[model samples]
Every structure is written in C-alpha cells, then in structure tokens.
Target: MSKDPEDRLTVGEVSRRTGVAISALHYYESLGLIASERTTGNQRRYPRYMLRRISLILVAKRLGISLTEVQHVFDTLPLDKLPTAHDWRRLSRLWHTQLEAKKREIEQLERELMGCIGCGCLSMKSCRLLNVDDELAELGPGPRRLDAAQAA
Candidate 1:
C-alpha cells in the first residue's frame, strides 16, 4: 500500500524539520518514545504528526526530564494523533511541582554544605570536631550526619 507522501516524512526530512539528529530519532524509536514505518524499500518513514512529538521530546529533555520519564508520559497518550495543548499544560503543571521540590532540596543541601565548609576542613569524616575518632564510621558510608539530619 502506498502512503500519501505529504502525510509521511523521511528520516532526513524529520531531522531537518525537528533539528534532532537522525541517529537520535532512531534512538528515540528504539526506546519507544517515537515510532516510524518502513517503506517497501526499508527506508524509515515517520508520520508528519511526529514533528510535534519530537518537539515535545526536545522540550522535555531541555527541562532535564529523563527519556524514561518522557516515555512513561508518552505511553499514556494515543499514538495516532498529536498531543493537544491541554496535554502540554498538564505536563507542565506536573513538572513544575517536581522541579520546585527538587529546588528546595538543592537549597537545603546548599545550606548544609555551607556549614560543612565553615570549619575549613576538606574531609567531613576526618574532621576532628565532626567525626571525632571516626565515630561516624559505625553509621555506615556517605554523609551520615546530613543523611541523619535529613531523615529527622
């Protein structure tokens, strides 16, 4: 069966229009983040609507969202149509909440890090005042004091 040329885009065409590399488009397909059809000659042919999907993927990546997360969201949508503006707004709201929580955690870590630097010590474990005879060694690895404080 012949696909209407206007409704389908070649790999190169998609790359040119979306500014995503051909290899990255293939990688996205491999991850199920996008999909394409093979022409009778085995060339890749993407639906024209995939341009919008690629844009959404690029936007999500720029926001530091992992491909796995993008795939999870994409999996929830119908594969036959472009995502609507409502979909974009819903995702934006969800990501905003998540990013805000991450910002707060980073700010908290910054405060803790400043305290650690105040003593002019390079090693928290070896610091005379903080570790005191390697007492934290018994608590296991990592920033035990910070971990404990955060837990509390």
Candidate 2:
C-alpha cells in the first residue's frame, strides 16, 4: 500500500511544495545532501524533513557557498536523524562567520581597486601597493604586498 499523503511526499509533490525541480532533488540526493526512500516499485519518496534541508541548501548557495561546503556543514550533524533546532543554530553561526569574512574581503578588494586607480602603476620606485621591489622577490611571484592588503 502507498504511504499516506501527509507522512511522505512523492518527488513531484516535493517539487511542487518547494518550487525546486525533481531533477534538482535527485541531484541533491546524489550529492548526499538529501536522502529518500525507494518504494517497492523503486519510486523515490521523501520525508518532510527534506524541506528544511533543501531550504538551507538554497539559502547557502545564494550566499555563494558551494554545495560541497554546505554538505560539510551537514556532515557535522548526526547521520541517523533529521537535523534539530540546535543543529540549525550551529549551522547558522558557522555560515554567519563565513559570510562576515567574505564581506570583509569584498570591502578590502573594493578599497584596493580605488587605490589602484590612484597609483596607476606609474611610480614603480614608490608604489608600495602594486610594484614588487627586489626586497620582496625572495617571497616568489605575485603581488608582494597583498598579504597585508593595506590598500596603498
């Protein structure tokens, strides 16, 4: 007998409820981010808990987080059970830190671009931000002063 509609959802139902495509849900399953059970006829069926996980995956991806990174976060939760309130809270804290770091990096990049406009690579002798002096050559190629990122 088929499961009642309230307890488990068919792939189409999940897609309809979440606005995610059936193929995407299958992709998520292949990535081990979400799981489903097979019916006797080998049809896919998902527990309602997947909605929460899918929502988180979508939101994290929107923030530029890769699915692999999100899977790493999910790995920290117990494999045998659905995620709990505390689990989501911990994930939120971890993502909040990552997002804050990214925000800072973007801000720094913007400032450096502004500084670059002023420097114009015109003053090789005095441009600390762009030109790599002989003194910094020992550290190898690439921008010598970017590690500190003082932005000129």
Candidate 3:
C-alpha cells in the first residue's frame, strides 16, 4: 500500500477518481453506506481506498440492495479500518448467496408467468397453473372464471 501523505484523498478527489458524482457520495454517507472525516474547515475527506468502497456501493445498488441493507453490511465492518482483501472476499461470499437467491426467485416468477400464459388464465383466483394457493380466499375476489373447466 502507498504510504505517501498525498495519497490520502479528499471527497472531491475520491469522486473524481471513482467517476461517481459528489452528490451520490454524500447520499452514500447519509445512508451510512460509506464513511468520512471532516477537516478543520468542515469539509469531508476520505481515504484513497474509499474509491473501492464507493464502487462496492454502486455494485450493491445495481444488485437491488436497499440502502438500509447496504448500511447493515457496512455496519459489520470495523469503523476505523479500511477493508482488507480478506474482508472483501468474505463479503463477496455473502453477496454470492444473495445473488443466487434472487436468481431463483426470478426463475420461479418466470415459471409461474409461463404457466399462466400457457393456461390462458387471466384471473388469479381460478388459475391453477399460476395460483399456488389452495383456497379461493388466498386471492381477493375480482374475477374467478379462470378454471380449466371454464376454459374448456
């Protein structure tokens, strides 16, 4: 790691280096997704490696993680310590599990949609192909003429 005193970055420098907007950086800070220190002038300063942290925030946002969830993930890290490679690897393992679960959910929804389309069932209550519920009350009443017998 570079130990040059000049290597420490200001918030503007981090924003320039990461190509992330300064407002987004502030938003990340407000969400507790990232951290910074205030200089004597009350300006925010960040470590040079915060570029990586901001990048991780962007990636997590793209993955559909809520800001609160992102904060929870960051909360697990040491407040004063920059993340090490081992820390990143551990986080990535958890992220992989989350991504896998999301993928399975999408696949399940796709299957359900396909079944509904194939069965020509537009009403949730009567659609055996799409409705996973065992009782009619599972879906609030609207239209119920979607049974296979009705289709026939």
Candidate 4:
C-alpha cells in the first residue's frame, strides 16, 4: 500500500506493481475485465484493489479463458467493485471445472496426435487420428471438421 492510504495509483503505478503492460491494462478495461476512473484531465486512476482484478485476469488468460469469459466473470460484480472472498471462491470453482475440461480435451488431442504419428499419413481419407474414413470423403474435403470442432 502507498504511504497515504487515500492516495490512488495511476495507471503507471498499477502497471508497474502488477507487471502487466499498460496497453494490456487498457485492453482489459476495454474488454470489461477491469475498470478505472478517469480524472478530470482524462488520466486513469485505479484503486489499489484493481491489482487483484488484474492478477485474476492474467491468471484466467493463462488458463486459456477468453476475454469474453473474463468479462462474464467480471459481470458478476458491480462496476468498479473489487471481488470479495466469496466471489473469488465462486470464480475459482468455475475455473477449475473449465480447466479440467480443457485438460481432458488436450489429453484426447495428444492421444489422437500419437495415433497420427504412428501412421505418417495425415490425409482425411486414411488418417486414423481423425477417424475419417473413405465414406466421409464424400461429405467434404480436407480435415473439414477436425480443426473446426476444437475451436468452437
């Protein structure tokens, strides 16, 4: 905390304290994952508590949570209000479930990738990894759905 308890941190101070880039902090604000007050001169002043929010956002991003998902979590709180302990608990539970699902998906993909490596053929018609057989060739060309399904 700053020596003066009432003194708010500027964007630079927050960026320095959190190790988050200033532009990334602005982007998080734009994405509604964090909020700040604009000074009369148009400078951004962030409460010290915003550090926690930024930290949470960084952690979520590391876990493959999209900006949209981060915004959804922020939406649970009132604007400019920092997360409470209860809120953190709830968010942690949600993230854990999502992380588990992503882990399973990665494991499945790794298994499929191993299968593909076992057979050097990456073609849709013959790649056992994709489970694409001759019958599916009539449906489309390429790994039509293998790549798209993972993203969606």
lDDT of each: 0.83, 0.79, 0.74, 0.79
Kindly report which residue stretches of model 4 are placed more than 4 angstroms away from their true locations once superposed.
Answer: 1-7, 128-152
Residue-by-residue lDDT tens digits, candidate 2, 1-152 = 22455777889988998899899999999988888888899998888778888888888988888898999998886543667889888988899999999999889767656767855765534554445354666667666667648666
RMSD of each: 7.0, 6.9, 6.1, 5.8
Task: List the candidates' TM-scores in order.
Answer: 0.77, 0.74, 0.76, 0.77
User: Over the stretch 1-152, how does candidate 3's per-residue lDDT look in tens digits?
Assistant: 33454656787788888888989988888887677776688887776777777777777778887677668788888655667888788877888888899899889878777767756645656565445664656555644445545868
Return the clash pairs for model 1, or none: none
Better of 1 and 2 by TM-score: 1
Q: Which predicted model would earn the best lDDT?
A: 1
Q: Output the TM-score of candidate 3.
A: 0.76
Which lDDT tens digits does candidate 4 get at residues 1-152?
A: 23344666898999899999999999988887777776789898887788889888888988889879888878887666667889889988999998999899889888778777757776766665655346666767766576578768
How accurate locally is residue 115 in candidate 3, as Cα lDDT from 0 to 100?
Answer: 67
Poorly placed runs, candidate 2 (over 4 Å): 1-5, 118-152
- lDDT over C-alpha atoms for residue 81 of model 1: 78
Clash count for candidate 3 is 0
Deviation in angstroms for 70 in model 4? 1.1
The per-residue C-alpha lDDT of model 3 at residue 12 equals 77
How much is 105 displaced in model 2, in angstroms?
A: 1.2
